[model samples]
Target: MSGHVIAIDGGGTSCRAALADAEGRVLGRGKRGSANIFTTSDTIGENIAAAAREAVCDAGLEGLPLKSIPAFLGLAGINVGERQRELAKALPFADTKFVHDGVIALQGALGDEDGVIAILGTGSVYLSRAGGVSRSIGGWGFAIGDQASGAVIGRALLQQALLAHDGVREHTPLSRAVMKRFEGNPEAMVEFAQQTARPADYGAFAPLMFEHDEKGDVLARDILLDAVRDITMALDAIVFEGCERLCLLGGLAGEYRKRLSPRHSAILQEPRGDALSGAVQLALRAFPPQAVGENG
Candidate 1:
């Protein structure tokens, strides 16, 4: 039998895994909850394994040799230096690689090819890889950065609503929509803000911003437009020195694709794979030489 590869794209919102052959043809796909190390505990390896196992099972494989598998993980909090070691002990494959989720996203979108990816989801980040060199922009987390994200937009919406309530701005559709989302209870709104975790939770409401904008809410339109601007700027910052390839990925990115400016759309490229596929690709690279037909 041909060897298999496992790729994982673990993020603040969810974990996805894909099983594939050396040719990159997919075998199975699986999904689970967030596997972000910074947001969760030291059990990140366990969580990632669970998600990968689920994908493997979904692909109708069991009792497979884990050691022979090659795996790649794009996890949210793992940086380039020593922090990756913490994850090395936890993954299933004999050989595994870890990078920031953005790098994984970029790889998924472009493979070994060079390009940039602007990801907007529970979090926002810009990544570019060209001529085997890579760079990043933003993705500092919710506290300091993540400018063009759902949390940022949600926070802005709430702030604007409060301002409207205080008569600082005129009433708008967003105020009504925001109030409705929280069931018209300010306390519930506060509770939602305090209790929820991750950028995706707030991003869940991103559609409302678009809807409000479509309905002619100036504030909502401004917020949406500004989000695009922020993402574009981040992309511009990291694009390869001679970049001609770029792509936008994520739930929000797909939803807002039609609304993106022509300049943004012109450079977009289709993704060659997904984070899960990238994980499987990583896994395949770890396979034993005899099994993979070559040294990984």
Candidate 2:
């Protein structure tokens, strides 16, 4: 256990860590609050350290020495090189490899093979790999982009409500539901938003839209359709030229697979693993046994 490898999925809403051996057997797992660098740098270092410690302890390695293991951290919004270096230097792992959250999620799902992975969480992103080349689309934070994300859906619903309140559109059941959720008029809505949490806080409303869509609500159907299309477009943008495998990750994407466009459906293949399992894969990759080691 002292020579264990750790894999982390540090995302916007939560961080998950897995401890695994050279053969990819998961020894332990741990979870913590959000660790997105974009929003939580104030405590990112401590959060990572705590998560690692917890994971190791869960793996029954609390008595072992520190700096005894190599670890791989898959972080959200780590597309920039500088950020990767900063996080690697900041974390406590002996040897650390940093990659985009989507990249690791893709790896978790597809191993080292070429494929596209679309993630639909509080935020959204698409990643693809082929011939050792990698590319990504969308995931530009919650404000400007992140199409198909829960935050975006919530924001859209709120905006539509605002328009209805301002007489910009006819009031509909969706608008009514939104207004009721906030319990306010236009000015009150603004005040509530100012004092409330971020766009992510509203992401919980995404399911309501889905429910409405199932009930044949036109706007809800449009929103759901648009989410599927956006997610597909993001995946389509980066799928390997010759690769035909596509894997959708995240709660929403996996659940809505049946709703995806037929063309997208045609290209997708089943994922072999999840992010946690991918973490185990990454751990084994980082800490392979000697050519003659027992687990090798």
Candidate 3:
């Protein structure tokens, strides 16, 4: 039997799915937890399946067999070919196309136009397309890259908190708040860091920094300024590479936008659509109705 198209935008923080008919009309949507291949590859299949199932149900097609669907997954941390193949095999859909999440973000943000996009959320990556050539910068994961990401900002806050506790750095409202969360015990902070060092755990502290920055906290300002510098560097590189239009995407995009210099912000353009829409676009490109054997 013929089936609907499924498009997924899977990231380190969450996975979103949408169902669309042959005519490219969206029927329903669903969401689930992290699907980052680097951190959650072992459970990626389950996460994708759960999100897809919910979207199908939301589309009023509950109990439909997932194997009948053709899905396109735009996922984080699937840049490596081996990882892509591994996750593709694990998915339940009869036909699946797996591409890095940046691809969908670019497609959604710029359509066929030449531009650059900086994705700053739980992790960070910069992508640019011009003259049919696409290039990616950073996105090396939270460990070595994602320099201006929430995870990095949050980790920096914790480090500053510890420095303040040690008298090596001046304590500000932001660092004090972090210390308070650990009950003023340095050991407690160490224990928490050792036990739960995931990107999301560190990313949880990002909002607090933003809040403190708005309140004029020196430490928070310092930390965020450093992040802004990193992001600005990436943006500069994109412009130097010949991209005239730029878009900032993800959770931290809005926050960073406010901090950017006018020169950098001047080129920012609103995205044409979100990542899910881009994934659906990719789904249509890869699994058009004719290719799926649909009868007109």
Strongest candidate by TM-score: 3
Write model 1 residue lDDT over 1-296, tens digit each, in one string. 33667778888888887777666677787777887776665666777778678767877887776566667778886763466786787666756877688876776688888888878777778887878888887777776788978778878787777677668988787887787777877777777777873566677777888777877888898888888777666766676567878777877777667776676677777788776655555555555335445436
Error of 1 at 116 (Å): 1.5
Residues 230-281, candidate 2, lDDT per residue (tens digit)? Answer: 8767766776667788887776775568787777788888888888787667
TM-score-better candidate, 1 vs 3: 3
lDDT of each: 0.74, 0.77, 0.89
Question: Residue 164, candidate 3: how far off, in angstroms?
Answer: 0.4
lDDT for 230 (candidate 1):
79
Question: What's the residue-level lDDT of 17 in candidate 1?
Answer: 78
For all predicted structures, in order, the TM-scores are: 0.85, 0.89, 0.95
- Segments of candidate 3 deviating more than 4 angstroms: 1-3, 240-242, 291-295
lDDT of 2 at 92: 73
lDDT of 1: 0.74
Candidate numbers sorted by lDDT from highest down: 3, 2, 1
